[model samples]
Target: MKTDVLIAGAGPVGLTMASELSRYGLSVRLVDKNTQRTDKSKAIVLWARTLELINRMSPNCADRFIETGLKTESVNILSGSEHIGHADMKEVDSKYKFVVMIPQSDTERLLEEHLATFNIKAERQTELTDFKETSDGVTYVLKHADGSEETAEASWLIGADGAHSIVRHKLNKEFHGSTLLSDWMLADIYLTGVQGTPAINIYWHADGILALFPLQGTRHRIIANVGESSGPIGEGNRPAPTVEDIQRVLDTRGPGGIKAEDSVWRSNFSINERKVDDYRSGRVFVAGDAAHVHSPAGGQGMNTGMQDAFNLTWKLALVSRGICQPEPLLSSYSAERSPVAKVLLEFTGRATEAALLRGGVKQSIRNHVASLVLGFAPVTHTMANLLSEISIGYSDSPLNAHTQHPRHGVKPGKRALIRENEPPVGFGDAPRFALFAESNNLPSALLLKYSALLEATPRAPLSPDSLSLVRPDGYVALATKSGDWNAVDAYLNQFLPKAS
Candidate 1:
């Protein structure tokens, strides 16, 4: 078999990788060892940024997701009977302000549906047993359930497999991080008497953290820290919690009058904060849990991985089409994403530590500080933006360039807004950079020179005296003054294919 890209794992992250590649007109083969998609609701929140990327791929598909998933607008934090703080997601600077509460199972289902529009289907029960890389491409073998082995070749291999990724192990990358000592329990159950509007309810009791994420209908996902681990982390010798255990934790930690029953899924697991040194090694690369794993405190585990797929797919598509040089385009993937994973790890670790604080005096101080800090509008708005992930940018990215003079509105390496009536940067079969400038002419000769890699017509600038080059993923690549064609040319030349 032959393909442009071979993706391992059929989970949400892998599905995202495959879907984006397919949408970009790349030939992708998605495979997984599991016979069926996940039925369990593991990772459940779709942040604003993730939804924005999905909409960039297909607006109608995103509409379906919104219709099926519940929209949560705020998060309420409490300490026993005392209310600590509330984060209003309405302040997020995007058209879609609320977090979409959809199950991972639902996410996979929808992504698979989207991929079908491109006539691509995941080959289930097919596992990547081994692989090797050559001078220009990669050779891989897939083992079917019947024990038959099929050999294939591809230009690139993506490892979006889960934490115990066979591809990561084969690449000899060390998943460097520590296993958190506390044991956590997650329960997806039907509940009654949920207080307030549909919002995330967090209780920082003296015992530990109890978080309630609202799901579709009466369903809710309850996750809590069950104190120190008595046994080893991996084997999970600890038994699954019952409805009574869930009730006990809620009664002790959450506000009164809520009841949980009719359990759907319940399991105990330990948190691990680990990531590889790089996201890519030659023709092979890792995304999702294969690249990083951290605490699920902010529900960013899946969103970050999906965004990883978003970041890599466009560059892969552009390079595969010979529209951009491979070195800087591909190398920037690790440079831009590695730091993001590190920041996420540290942020989640701090949140987990804060929730686990013990002793009366320390707990009181923590509650007081949280209340006072979150009371301010700027504090709440910033926290809301962080949680929604709309504030993520690549200002430090190697791909970003600047002019001598600064411009207003969106800065280079930051996110540039897409007008409500305008198509997104990467809307067509190929990924093309959008040029925003005050001048209407924009030297059509220059655009024609790189038509395959750039949009044909220049878009009206959002601000006067500003010219911006926006990446396919909707981030500003170059922000300069009007008619700074030299700056734009230099930036594109870095990734543009060299002249023959």
Candidate 2:
């Protein structure tokens, strides 16, 4: 294979997958038909959990893109005349809370900048013309804008292209879901709000789902799902939104309002909820909108796509390095991400439904009751964190089933900090299957029974008592307490080669 991985589309998800795979010392090639990434931002936020995972994947990650230009303090949802509830991202105790509002363009630019350090660049204006997949890998015909065609082979091909993805079509993955027949409008503009006040995402029911996301300092974004009776924008995607639309929504929002002004960019969109029948297809897999495209109510599209890369990157790297059997590690990728995507789809869809309610007393009662109850419920306080992102854990993984042996400072199922004395929230995303054999600290324990798993699989970078086994794509394969050889050997031999 000329390249270990070929990523189709240089959007956030594809770019991230490339960066992550490159981290494993793999040769990654990325292609995009877009001549250039635009300055206009589309998706406008990064959740805390995603940011944390990105930082873990690339330590210098957070500092690179996280500017004062990007930070939303919190989220407030208005229900009719009353303030229903708010999501305090600060409560998550993350340096970045809720979602950091940066335009999609800037995000792509930042990711591209990072990829540059790795000596990788997006082959722009290059389209995948023909693709052939064999049991071993995939080969694709790349047609340059100038009409020259070149063939490239890679052990794996990832499709991160958007909804109209050609890769998913070729794979014949079923996207079994419904699209909202009603139309919606989206706009990005400068609002009069100060830098730190809580950004409001109001649900007035009858008015349709209206969301206002903070970006950088004073700029903001608005997305409104239009009522069916309102009629569709004759040119879907080309609504030509005017100050009239902005003024109308603001006027509808009852008094004590902060005005949004000086609209910069505008467009209309139709919301849809959909997911692929499966994310993997032989040596070709799908991520981001290609795999699962849902309504962007929770702002989870980009976050989910990037997280998919995080899950797949380490696994692909480890398998390529002969650290573990390719199947086991790769299988875990879909297992982990699919569930997360399902939950996100459900949450965002429900939020959208509630936001786009038609005028009625029943709607009023439902909105008022929810707002009242949620205001006092502690569970409501966690809504922002849940919506922002989730910290995926492998403790529930069937492959990671094992009993724990207690250590003084060490704990089971936690990503143990390698050298730090401090207690860890979570750590360790190394691309190798790590087994922590603290028993006797002997070479025999590591080399004999656990040899195949230990040969290329390094010891847990975090500690001695912990056995941190990583999958090829860099997620914790199995992190169990170090103990006897019998069970550990059986567990590993199931997936790795036996000692010579």
Candidate 3:
């Protein structure tokens, strides 16, 4: 059998890759070794930037997530019973300002449903056992639950297969990082007598860190650091936290007078901070946990993985359809996303270390500094943007281009703001750049020449002096002075097929 893309795994990241590729009219075969999706409520929050990317996939698709999940408007930091500071989600510049709290299971189900609209369904109980990449495509083998094997060919292959990825292993790429020795407990349960707005609460206690994430209705998720681990880092080896265990932590760490009951899920696991230096190897690519996994401090693990899918698929679609060359266009994927993952790992690692500080003068000093720093509006706003991932940008991306006299507004490689009632960038079947400039300012000749790669009409510019070309994934590709058509032309020329 033949397909345009062969995706391994069916988690949120894999589902996202399949959905984006299929939405772009590519043939996709999604497979997973597991017969069913996860029932556990892993990865509990979807940041604003992720929701904006989902909005581009289809109109009202992000709305489905917003409706089904809980919305958190702010995050409060506390030292035992005393309030330290808080970050307001409203400070984020995106239209979807608040973070949506949805379980990984529901996220997968929703992504699968969206992919089904394009007539693609994930093949369960099927695993990718081996593969060999050729010049033009990848030839792979799949093993079924019934001990049967099938050979297939695809123009490309993606390993969203996770940390234990067979595809990543086959590529001989090392997942470079270490697992922390500390064990943390996670619980999803119903809580009564919990005070405050629908917000994420983090309590810095003398013992460890305890966080409460509000879910739909009366349900909440609790995470706490227990102590040093005596065993390995896998979740299977760690004992599950009982309701009593959760209540004990809450009573000791959380703000006074909160009861934990009706437990739904509980598990203890160690944090692994690992990432691959490159996201791509020849015609194959690894995303999500296959490429990077970090601390859960910022709730960025799943969102980062999903964004990796968002960033790679548009480029893949353009190249696969012969609309662009395979050189710089494909190489830019790793160049763009790898740095973002590196930053995330460092940020999450710092956050985890800060929260795990043992009680002493150092812990007191840390709490004092955090409270003092977070009290500043700018500090809190920056934290909000970082945590929600609205501030992520590829300023150093190879795909970024600019003229000498570029106007000042949104610079090259920054995300253009998604305004209300306006259609997002990259909002169609074909992967094309959206032009942000006055219609009258754009020359018909320039539009005609790159019509295959550019959006038909130019939207209003950020400033009258700026002419911006935003990529299909909504990052700035070219930011030049208004009426500088030469820069735009030169930028698009790089992706054009070379003469033989």
Candidate 4:
């Protein structure tokens, strides 16, 4: 079997990359070792920026994903049944504030549905055993569940596989980070007799931190920082989570001493933060968990991964089609994403530490401070935006770099912030440059010169350019003041065709 691109591990990020490549009219095939979607809701929040990006890809896709999941408005902090503070994300620019309580399996299922529209479905029950990459492309010896072996080749391969990524290992890449000293457990349960459970709850008990996230329609998904959240359950350790062990937590944590139905699903995972030294090894590249991993406390894990897919696909598409030089563009993948991984890891680590403090005056002081700060509008909105995963921006890629031509052709660097447009749509295979003019058309002067690669849109008004160019993966490619075309050719030449 062969493909122009083969993505391994069809988690949200992998599936997204596959679908994105399809949108560019590229041949893409997605592969996963999992036999089917697992019924667990791991990552539940999509930030404002991500929603904006999705709107460009397919407006209703983001809305449908929202409609499919449980949505919450407030982030409540508690101390052993005592209310500390309630942070409402509704204030954030995005319409959603609390993490949407959707199961991970549902995310995969819905993403799969979106990909099917592009004629790409994740190939299941297949494993890549012997895969090699060279300067030109990648080749793999895959094993089928039926005990047959086949050879596959691709112009490029994306390893969206999770932490223990074979693609990362095959590249002889190193993962540098520490496994957390503690583990945790998350479970989804339906409330039977209990009435009116809160939308979202966090209990900072003397024992540990426990969070109850309300599923859009289901009762709740409980995430507990039970001193490593998972281990042998005994000696007041919740007894290691058998059906009986899990039932005990549900019963004990019940509202008003109320007992709830058993968990519909359960998962135990450890905490760790790590990054791949290199994202690209010749024609094979790593994205999402393949590139970085971190504790899920901030819910940034899934967001970070999906953004990686978003960043890489457009670059690959441009280079493969002879639009830009592959080496420089590929190198930007690590340069742009490494810093983001670092920031997310640090913030999530801080949130986790603050949530799981041992009892003491110092701990009390810290908890008091956390609650106080959380009560502030700015603090909660900041954390909420980070969790939504839309606040991030990328540095100098060919498509997004500050050009010598004119106006605001270059943006605010990786931290640049732009307001979202009401009706968002891309200029056909463009994730890099969005053109905005009052006339709602390309700069007539440069249109013929860069017409083959650039698309100018006149939607609403995005500032001067009033339009934004999104990379194929959906980050702003470049922003320009209205009618600035001095460096247009220079910029386009970096990633697309230019006048001979």
Candidate 5:
């Protein structure tokens, strides 16, 4: 069998890749070795930027997530019983201002259901055992649960297969990074006496950091550092924490009066901060845990991976359909997303280290500094934007183009503000850029020449002096003087087929 794209692993990242490709009318086959979806609540918070991107997938697609998941409006930082500072999600610059607290299991299920709407279901119990990539495409072998092997060909291969990805291994890419020696425990259970509204509460205690993330109703997720590890870092190396163990930590570290009961899940794990330098190798690419995995500190691990799929698929769709050139368009995937992972790794690593501050003098100074810094409105606002991922941009991307005109308003490579009641930039079966300028300012000849690369009608411009060409993924591709049609044409020409 043959397809346009062969996606390995049916987790959230792979599901997202398949969904976006299929939405663009591409043939996609998603395969996973697991027989069933996960029941564990794994990576739990879907930030505002992720929800905004999901909205572009289809009408009311994000609404399904908002309805099913719990909405958290703020993150509070505390030093034992005293409140240090807080970052309010209401201040985030997006329509979906609040972070949605949904389980990874539910996220995968919803993504799979969305993929089904495209008439594509994940091939479960089927694993990618081997693959060889030629100059034009990839030919691979899949091993079935019953021991039958099937050979298939695809125009491209995606490894969303996760940390132990066979695809990444086959490409001979080194995942270089170190693992922290400290151990941490995670618990999902019914709890009482968690104070205040449904917010993320982080208590910086002398022992370690204790964070309580509220789920639907009375359920909550608790994570705490439990000192340095004595054994190797892997599952079953440390025993799962009991309810009593959780309660003890909560009593000692939390802001008092929190009772733990009716435990649902409990596990202990070590944090690994590892990533590959490049996300793509020839016709194959790795995403999610396959490419990078960082500290769960800010719950960015899953959202970053999902956004990787979002960024890569639209470019893939355009190239595979012969609408765009393959060079810079495909190469931009790694160039753009690799920096994001690099930044994320550094940010999460710093956060983890800050939380694990041991010495009393260092802890006191860290707490004092954090309290003072977060007390500023601008600091808290920036914190909120970073946590929700609203501030992520590819300013240095090879795809970015700008005119010599003085920069004003949203610059090239920044995300255009997603306004209410307005359809997103990439909302249809075809991946096309949206032009944001007065209809009269648009040259009819320009639209006619690059119809496959641009939207038919121009929306309202950011400013009367400036026009913007936004990518299918909502990033600013070209920002220049309002009447600069020549700049727009030149920008579009770079991606158009050579014959065109």
Candidate 6:
């Protein structure tokens, strides 16, 4: 069967991509080699930015996620008995200001249920064995469980298939970077001595870093750096850590008095920071671990991948519908997202390195400096916003356009925060730019001419006599004064043909 988009790997990223395309009234078939969704709570914690983006897709979407997840407002860091630093999510400048602690399992389940609203289900045990990208479309070879192969054609192909992506391999793209030297351990268990508030508690010990992430009532996820590795830990090669193994780390690094029991999931892992140079090649693209993987320092791995889906799917939808030209719209995907990935990699790498520091002098200095710096409210607020990903934007994107007389508040490539009861820019079945200007000052001819590419009516302006054109993904594309209708026309005209 032919489809508009064929998604490989029904993980969170692929599911998100398919859900978005389907939401935009596009045909999508999601396929996975695995027969069923993961039962383990692998990647946990959806930050504020993710929830905000999901809410833009549908009013009830983010609400559903909030219902199933536990909310934590602050992350406290301690060194030995001394309080080092803390990140207070309450300081984040967003409506959903806290981190939502939900397992990757529940995330996928809820996403699948959401996809069911579109009458779509992921085909199980079906894998993309091979494919070729032609000028017209992508031809994919699907291998079934019983070894039967069927060929299908699709207008586009997305590989969310994971780190060992066949699509990336077929494209001959290099996954550059290195594996971190330290071995890590992750445990999901029920704890007894978690006191006071259920905040994320992290202890930076001289030995290693031990982090406790609250999942549910009395249930927490424990992750720690366990020193140098003999070699890379392979899947299922290393046995699960026993209760005593976790207790030892807790007794040595924890803030004292926490007892562990009722172990749910435990495994040993090594951190690897690898990413491809580009996200798109011809009609094929990759997201999630397939495109980038990094140290789980700030829990940004899955969130970043999912945002990649959010970023690309909107542009792809617009281009596929012939509303926007392919050159800048499609090309901007890599230009915009690749830099974000690079920044994330550097941040996570430094975090992991600091956490794994073995030298006593360096560790002491780090702890002392951290305490002094993070004690400031502004520093903590910045950390909170960065961790929540509310501060990320395509500041250098090719799509960003600015006028000489730019407005003061909203700049190009920055997020345009929408208020309550108002529809967000790019919210609906089709992707369209929202023009924010005074109703009288809005150029009626421009709106009439580019009705297919713009909002039906101008929304209330942020500043009087100022005009802002926001993209589908909520980033400001053009910011200029009200009289600069010519600039706005030029910005929109790039996405259309010269003859038009």
Local error of candidate 5 at residue 281 (angstroms): 0.7
Evaluate model 2: give its TM-score.
Answer: 0.86
What would the TM-scores of all predictions be? 0.98, 0.86, 0.98, 0.87, 0.98, 0.97
Better of 2 and 6 by lDDT: 6
Writing each residue's lDDT as its tens digit, candidate 1 over 1-500 gives 57999999999989999989998888999999999999999999998888888888786457778888999999888886788998898999888889899998999999999889899999999999999998888999999999999998999999998999999999999999999888999899999988778999899998899999999889999999897877876627478999999999988988878899799999988989999989999999999999999898889999999999999999999998888889798999999999999999999999899989989899899999999999999999999989988889998998888667555557778889868888878887788899988765577768877788888888888688888889999999888888888887787878888887
Report the lDDT of model 1 for residue 336. 93
Query: Candidate 1 vs candidate 2: which has greater TM-score?
Result: 1
Model 2, runs deviating above 4 Å: 93-98, 193-200, 229-238, 254-257, 394-398, 402-430, 433-444, 447-490, 497-500
lDDT (0 to 1) per candidate: 0.89, 0.70, 0.90, 0.68, 0.91, 0.88
Candidate 2, 169-225: lDDT as tens digits: 888888767777667777787877433464656656466666777676667787776
Better of 4 and 5 by lDDT: 5
- The TM-score between candidate 3 and the true structure equals 0.98
lDDT of 4 by residue, 461-484 (tens): 445444344444445555666544
lDDT of 3 at 263: 88
Better of 2 and 4 by lDDT: 2
Q: Write the per-residue lDDT of candidate 6 for residues 1-500, one digit (tens) a residue.
A: 66989999999999999989998888999999998999999888899989988887776589889999999999888887898899999998888889999999999999999889899999999999999999879999999999999999999999999989999999999999988777788999999987777788888998899999999888899999776766545433356678899999999999889999989999988888999999999999999999999898889998999999999998889888877778788989889888988999999898888777788999999988889999998999999989998889998999998578765448888878867778767778888898888777666899898988898988888777788889988889988887678888999998984454
Q: Model 4 has how many clashing residue pairs?
A: 22
Evaluated at residue 66, the lDDT of candidate 6 is 91
Best by lDDT: 5
The candidate with the higher TM-score, 4 or 5, is: 5
Q: What is the overall TM-score of model 6 with all chains considered together?
A: 0.97
Off by over 4 Å in 1: none
Superposed Cα deviation of residue 239, candidate 6 (Å): 2.4
Q: After aligning candidate 6 to the native by TM-score, how far in Å is the CA of 376 from where it should be?
A: 2.0
Off by over 4 Å in 3: none
